[model samples]
Target: MIVKPRLPVINRAHPLAKGLVADYPFFERGGTTLRDISGNNNHGTLTSMDPAVKWILTSQGYGLDFDTTDYVTIPDSDILDFGTSPFFVETWIKTTVNNVRQVAVAKADVTGNFIFEMGTYRTLTANEIYCEFYVSGLYPKVLVVDSSFFDGKVHHLVAGHDGTAVRLFIDGVLRGSNVSAYGNIDTASWAIGTYGAYSPPFRGWNGQIAKTRVWKKAPIAREIATLYADPWALYRSRRGIIGKAVAAAGVTYPQLERSFQRGAFRGIKMGVAA
Candidate 1:
């Protein structure tokens, strides 16, 4: 005779649910951080930073007066770990040049292989703002933005190559797409606000930049859009109610929890005096 095994009954107060409830605060903390990165502190705008792992542009080196300030420079030794092929680059840029080349970020052999800046008219014309990436032995690939899309406003720009295709995003929207491969070139160091050539380096951006991030994986279109749509939301959620309340006021996690508990634990007295 075959005996039927009894099924395990799921308890209403299961450990999974309990853990989730207990850990909600931790998840909320991460949201707060995202809010901060997304410019919740200042007016809602993106920013950029130097790309070399340990180097950051100084205050005078990074703001709207980039034309007057000497370009912030980074040494090749600082970026020894960056791989050539699969990577992403994103920055927020404003230009001061009327009709000149302004490089926002670059990493290349000073003389030979370079992924640098290339553009003709700088007067916010169609395809006037763009970046060029040159692999050692391969044809260089260029990513351009139509002036109609980004123009002179503070805009978020992102570019990534994932072995198969190259993708570009403007303010979280996919604007350019192509297929390219950077085989085995070693891009030793990366600089921000200037081109890499010594003789006539593209000196300084004429605008502002903030919140630059580099990820190994090329973020998908949806993910990029989501980030652009509510850059502060992720950071805000991580902070939880207390942090959010402190940052923006009138909203607290405890207040929310109390409201939820009142509804969720209707019959059960949570074992505490009100």
Candidate 2:
């Protein structure tokens, strides 16, 4: 029997290089389309974007600015379904409005039909907000609370189900979690920058959002930490996947000096294979 060799992560940019389900760089100048660079066909349509002023550019590049009521929607498909399997979502957001709920990404419908919704929701305390990953009523998620996200600055946010617990990471730190358990997930259209489009209380996000990614896997803490430490790596990483893994996942690249060869492979770092 052949054994699969274990190797160090090639890029350490993010965990999504292997199981990227969707990617939105928010780079389209068309002002109406958010291209899915992941090649997963999960394209989104801008509800009310103006080519002239809807985008904001920084040293990192362009990002979509939402006005609470605006959001991007993706059509329903089989690949979007995550079921009870592990899954994760990551994105960069900047906003000061956290008094009420603000949805960053959601694929849910009321009346029992649901998948998941990740966003900032008002807590019992006045003006206090907490991040939530609502799976469904049957598997309601616990709040991942942290008050610093309302600072109106660029921050990395991540949430995921790691087969056991629902987790939330802010700026690469694991902030909170809850016991996670759910049956097969429903197939619903995806919405970004707001909650459900077919329902009320959209929980719109009034801010700039960019570099949203989804993966059908558990949360990888090291990957998140690396990305938070080197924010530019996120931008440096290629847009789409190269065949299976990320374009420069470092497997074949000798830059990292990581190596995984045939049989009883030594714990080697990637670099110019020699």
Candidate 3:
């Protein structure tokens, strides 16, 4: 049987719920509105969704697919504006398109020259990963990692800036970092999948995304590692099964139960469920 555990809902028990600015599990569909469970009411609007807001069923419930032409737009709020204090953008992405500059998440002004961005470092084979944020009185630091995450499998990524420096983490491991000062960057609305004023030839992400989140405080490395190692420890969830030993035509509940209890069953367990 292929056991698909029910996705979770986080409350105070969630390790990083403290400064969560927004959380998008992308599990259950909510029309054009991508619900944000952070209780900050920063839900995003699906703009130009190619499949009219497509959500593909996964073991985690649902994952949104983004074509190069669509993106999510979240309104501006003070909580989202880090102002060079401390902040991070994190997400799970799976893709095979490393030949182009793909934007994962970014916040920019109307003219497309402001604040921060976390996206592909550049284009082509083994396209690097990167994060950039502007701090008043200083040029933005373009923190780029030497590797890529476009291997057609799901991977966790994080872009963060502590008060004094910037950091990048991939799959719970620190990929790279750079020393940087801080101050007020511009305050702007958020754009997912694509960035830069949502213009023509957008820096769109052509892939699947699940569980995107942001925190206004710097992430603790130990906490991040803990989340990567034991995601279930932070959230409560139920599990379900399907196929094979799963209940089938004419299979009585008792029979199915016996089968599930005895038959050699396999479960798809993703590493670092966070």
Candidate 4:
């Protein structure tokens, strides 16, 4: 028998929740609209449906599927306009397409002068999944994963600048990091499943994307690991050992106290290493 751990309770007013600007759960069964659960009204509009987009059962519940010609368009908003602030983009994806640059998520202007994309790129030897942030006149930071996730298996991909470095994580493990200046992203719109009109030849992603999240604040290594463990769980991003211990077990205040009195959680390491 497989045992599923109980999910933790999250405080909605916590800073972690507030820092999440765009959250696409893709929970709807059938519709052209994909609602943003971040409470910031950053809903995505579907366009150019070749076979009509719809939600299907994925490893992580219901997820929206996009054909090669379909994509989701999110209008420009202050919440998405990160002006040199630390930011991260994450999504759960599965695809078998190779030899093509496919975009999972992107923010770009109509002319594609400046663009930011978190997607898969084609290389001579293999395809690479990366998070790229670029400025019109500046060098862009592209953090790529060493291994590919194109085996038709659902995998987690995350790319972001954590204040000091641009990092990429696959399935909760840090794969690559680079130190560079990620210029501000001032695009007029954001697209999921395609790169709009970016200069790069990367086009729409022909796969299944379960969820996508954008955070204005940089997530540390521990937080990234925690996210890989429980993608939907909400906890304080920057917390001490004690706070992290409680979250690791998904215990409430009372449960934590009881566990302490019983010495059940003693000597238990916290964070991702645990």
Error of 3 at 173 (Å): 0.4
* Each candidate's clash count: 19, 8, 0, 0
- Cα lDDT tens digits for candidate 4, 75-191: 899989888888888889988876677888888877865457777777665567777766447645564634558888778888887767778888888888778776776656888
Q: What is the Cα-based TM-score of model 4?
A: 0.76
lDDT of 2 by residue, 1-274 (tens): 2222221222335443678778776555445777776667788888866756776653233577888867888787777788778888888887787667778877766443546777677767433434444554565565655567777777888887788887788889888788856545546677888765556336778888877888888888997787566543433334433212423353422222122333223553321112
TM-score (all chains, Cα) for each model:
0.56, 0.74, 0.76, 0.76
Error of 1 at 69 (Å): 5.2
User: By lDDT, who's the top model here?
Assistant: 4
Q: Rate the local accuracy (lDDT) of all candidates.
A: 0.44, 0.64, 0.66, 0.70
For model 1, residues 196-272, the per-residue Cα lDDT tens digits are: 54432445565555444444455478767865664333223333443344357543433433543457535432212
Best-to-worst ranking by lDDT: 4, 3, 2, 1
In candidate 4, which residue ranges exceed 4 Å CA deviation?
1-15, 50-53, 136-138, 143-148, 197-202, 235-274
Candidate 3 displacement at residue 51 in angstroms? 4.9
Cα lDDT, model 1, residue 125: 50
Which regions of candidate 2 deviate over 4 angstroms?
1-16, 58-60, 110-113, 126-136, 231-274
Error of 1 at 114 (Å): 1.0
